[model samples]
Target: MANKPSPSPTWDEYVSELGRNLQRARISSGLSQEQVAYRSHLSRYTYQKLESGIARPGAPANPTLRTLVTVARILAVEVSQILPAAAPDLPEP
Candidate 1:
């Protein structure tokens, strides 16, 4: 039998991508996790959780717009760089 193609990425996948971008940016800047968190005005533990790809245990990391912009500023990366190219579909508010 032929293998089936995977379905579209879920919200969790998007969150994972964001985490990856954050890690890459931090590495490129030669900044420690603690440094990034502190500069971003986030707690080290909370930053660790985001870098680990979860907002909480068994949950996706859906950061608020303020948080995203703040982290991007600290990392010197564009917000678009930290966001997945494609995101899960959501109804218009």
Candidate 2:
């Protein structure tokens, strides 16, 4: 049988988790959102949305890799540190 794709969290779940991770990292680093935003060269509103996982109209923030990288650098963490762990390749039968 062909290999099936791995199960993963829903988009909302993933985005929410990412936001939580970012928030935790920021707090642990003793940096406020505004400070991180300034250091990352991103608008405060954009960084808020990213950390909250909600865009205008109640949609997920869905930040780009570049944004994540920039924020990670400002927070002094590797990108993987903010990413969710890999899901299992397949669900059990």
Best by lDDT: 2
Local error of candidate 2 at residue 10 (angstroms): 0.6
The TM-score leader among the candidates is 1
10 residues in a row with least lDDT, candidate 1: 83-92
What is the C-alpha lDDT profile of model 1 across 1-93, one tens digit per residue?
Answer: 999865657788778888898899889989999998898888998998888789888898878899889988988889998887876655468
Per-residue accuracy of model 2 over 2-93 as CA lDDT, tens digit each: 99977787677788888899999999999999999999999999999988888876687778899999899989999999987753234467
Q: How high is the CA lDDT of each candidate model?
A: 0.85, 0.86
Provide the lDDT at 69 for model 2.
94
Model 1 local distance difference test score: 0.85
Candidate 1 off by > 4 Å: 1-7, 90-93
TM per candidate: 0.84, 0.81
- RMSD in angstroms, all models? 3.1, 6.3
